[model samples]
Target chain A: MEFLLQLYADQTRWSTLPPDQAHAEMGAYAAYTQALHDAGVFVAGERLAPPSSAASVRVSADGKASVVDGPYPETKEQLGGYYVIDVADHDAAVSWAARCPGASHGTVEVRPIMAVPTAA
Target chain B: MNSRPAAYAVAERAARESYGKLLAYLAARSGNIDAAQDALADAFTSALERWPLDGVPRTPDAWLLVSARHRLFDRHRRDVRAERLHGALAAAARDAQRDFERAGEIGDERLAFMFACTAAAIAPEMRAPLMLQLVLGLDAARIASAFLIAPAAMSQRLVRAKRKIAAAGTPLPRVSPDDLSARIDAVLAAVYAAFSAGWSDPAGVDPRVSGLAVEALWLGRLVADIVPDDPETLGLLALMLHADARRAARRDSTGAYVPLAEQNTRLWNAAQIDEAESLLRRAARARRPGRFQLEAAIQSAYAEYRFGREPAWNAIVALYDGLLRIAGSPVVALNRAVAVGRLRGAPAGLLALDDVAVRSDLRDYQPYWAARADLLAATGARAEAYRAFERAAGLSVDPAVRGYLLGCARRLGTAQPSAPSSASEGKSPG
Candidate 1:
């Protein structure tokens, strides 16, 4: 099964880190990614820009579109990054989620990807 | 004797013993469970049609394997990809055939198949049904009957489960010991579920249904053999064997329910008791006591009674205490209370029930009410005891048990008004 882990964190906490500490954090993430690759489970992942620079788009039922600035600002937690990994079951996915760096201070939401059956 | 009837008998016996082995072996080798099942079904049909005329082959399993392999080859020949791999497929089939002919066993393929059938990818609720069908070759109707569900619904559930498994692709290689140990509980639960289904009715009117307990025990024994050091597996085998040994005494000559304590110890299967005792000893050697081991130990304590000897109620109480410490379920607590009632005075047992009484799940539980009535009657509280027994009789599904509880209530009512009832005089619940 393929599971998506969405990492969420407080924007201010991430922004306040020292430059060298931020560098070390990135190195840790790289090593983690390498470990997943070695385990042959890595699918795809990416770090997102800050919520301060984010925008939201909504399409009404009538098909009229509206754009908002700053991710609406009321949301305290921001989506920082995500990773997709192939695992055996929910337990395996949860075990991987526990090892996520985000788990220490923030949250990682693990969701199983529903398989859309392909006609054979 | 007609050869046709004798041939059918041999086929029936083969279905009971070798169906799982042949199906599991083919499924593992082919990596296509559905196809393997289809081929094996066809093989069985062919056996029924041809066995009488052919006078039963010396190596029935090998004959069935070869027939199923041919069907597999025919199915593969239709696929373009299989056409390219014909040489490899033929070579593999030959090897499997040779192995089957030389040795009746499938090495560890059945074990591998068991793990695959209960794989985590499949929904937890569906594992046992899938195991019954895929491993034991039980049809959907029988599996549905065992689960008390409509056959159509059971068939649909099976289809969905099988599709999900097939979608996941070929079963993964043998899992690590850590993974095996983690899923051991669920696997054991499935086997026990099958056993309970069989043992639920002591009359054994339907051999297909009643024989499930034997199959489950066989599966448990095979698992214990494969995982020799797993204490819980040994414990599970012991538990099933202990319960199975008392099958004969569970019902009276007239088919009335016989509670464990009132059963004739001579009716118990001596060999099964011996096997269960040995298994319990082996599991105890592991020193990591699990729920099943504790439960088996309790049964072992009861099995020690023989030749008009009193049961070691104190040992049973201690084992129940150990079990309560580990499991802590209301049901186990109720059982422990019965044991305590047998060992200590009725008042002490009544006091112990208070701790478990807080659990809302036991409000209408038959055993709880039955145990409570026994304790109440023991303490000379006839009025409360009568009410509890009435409630227990109302709740009991078994007619014999309901009759017994009603009899207890009537006997208590008719006793002299001033006399305190001897609650501890009757046999404890099984």
Candidate 2:
């Protein structure tokens, strides 16, 4: 089981976390993930670059695959990072999702991974 | 550099091993957010466990969706917050809330998912992968296999797609009666590809593939509702009806095997045949061409002659040519080769199919080899043909196909005596 914690912060709430404090909070997130890893439940995790560095693309009707530069549609909130935690079930995934600093600060989108078709 | 092919394959394998189904029991109660998400999470976890052992169940889409509903109900029982999430889904048969509405995004059901994936904010390369993941519930690794990339690259693409979809906040396209026709095109194309993976499964033993066809049909019906007058929409529905009408007849009563030309036409679906014929005629008269209408026309033509006259290989060939012009793909070319074989002999067809082997997507596809076996035999290369038949038999998930191919191989004097039916078959979408 894997839980994806989608982090976002309202401008006001985000700006209030001073740079130094924000760094400390991120450190806490790292520490929590390390705990998960040491316990052998952590699959993969990463902090995303700010939305400002994002890019987007779409295929037009004429069959053209096009690329553009931007944080895909502009929104006030931005995705900060993600945590993929391996656990027993939804309950376990939820417990792990809550451990992410984003849960306290922004919304976390937790999704379970799909099993693949074994080679015949 | 850190991602080795074997390791990448293993990582991809892990992703596929993890899907499970959740039951949101309280979905009938209220619009509880936590309950809903929890149910979704639970269902996904179940998807992971169930698929490997049981293979994907027939109602996987509904299974996951229902899991969410069940999970929500469980949550409702446990917490006051879930009452609404539980209620909304219960009452949602008619008055469902559109899940996501962003700028420039519209329509209901899976299309919303597709539009989000296709949203301008996401990269062009990200669109198909996103839809493959979210709507079809494929893992990044399986998706990576399709694109022939490392899991990391595929995972990165998905992440990039999600960020754009989230940021775009674009309004979902609201299809008016006027724009409905065009909208249906995009919707059908998306649904067609996904559903095809299900519908084309030779492994009829596994029922899970049924969801793929059912969902595609569901989406096609939705498209029909909006553009009821669109002949192409009608064609798609009619075509499916026509093909499905022969389901029982396609195989013998004992479920052994019966090819289309040998099947009794009296069992042919007259209603579906009628519907497809009408739709095809209408579309042809319109003089405007679309892929669905063309493909449907081809099927209708084939079905029409399947029982009565010699199969109309000429009309079928023409249809494939028209299809190639609209969507020129190697798979399309492979299909067209069959038609050419009918007209010019299997020898000519094999000459054309030589290029099919190198194409990556079709490498694992069993039919490609099966077709090659037939062509080789027809051209008098019986030994080589038996080998081809064996290769196809080795890869096929369908018991019936395996039986049929093995029978062919035996006839050619090359046979394998022991091969167990391992694991299960592909999901046979209805």
Q: Each prediction's Cα RMSD?
A: 20.1, 22.3
**Poorest 10 consecutive residues by lDDT, candidate 1 chain B:** B198-207
Q: How well is candidate 2 docked (DockQ)?
A: 0.01
lDDT per residue as tens, model 1, B321-370: 88878777766776777777778878888888876787645643556666
Q: Per-residue alpha-carbon lDDT of model 2 for B1-430, expressed as tens digits?
A: 6545545444333332222111112222222323333446667766665555555554444555555556656666987755654565445412222221222111224444454455556665455556666643566776653433446667876766665654554333444667656656655665564445422432222222233444345445655665576777776776565556566665566665454555677877677678667767776776777777877776676675555666577887888888889877766677777667766887877876776556535543456666677777777787877776665555443445455665666667744332211111121111
Q: Once model 2 is optimally superposed onto the true structure by TM-score, how far is the C-alpha of residue B365 displaced, in angstroms?
A: 2.3
TM-scores, each model vs. reference: 0.65, 0.51
Worst 10 residues of 1 chain A by lDDT: A23-32
The i-RMS of every model, in angstroms, reads: 26.7, 22.0
Candidate 2 Cα deviation (angstroms), residue B257: 3.2
Tens digits of per-residue lDDT, candidate 2, A53-100, equal 778889999999988876656776677776776777764555455435
Superposed Cα deviation of residue B338, candidate 2 (Å): 1.0
Among the numbered candidates, top TM-score falls to: 1
Q: Candidate 2: where are CA atoms >4 Å away?
A: A1-120, B1-114, B117-165, B175-183, B199-211, B358-361, B414-430
Weakest ten-residue segment in model 2 chain B by summed lDDT: B420-429
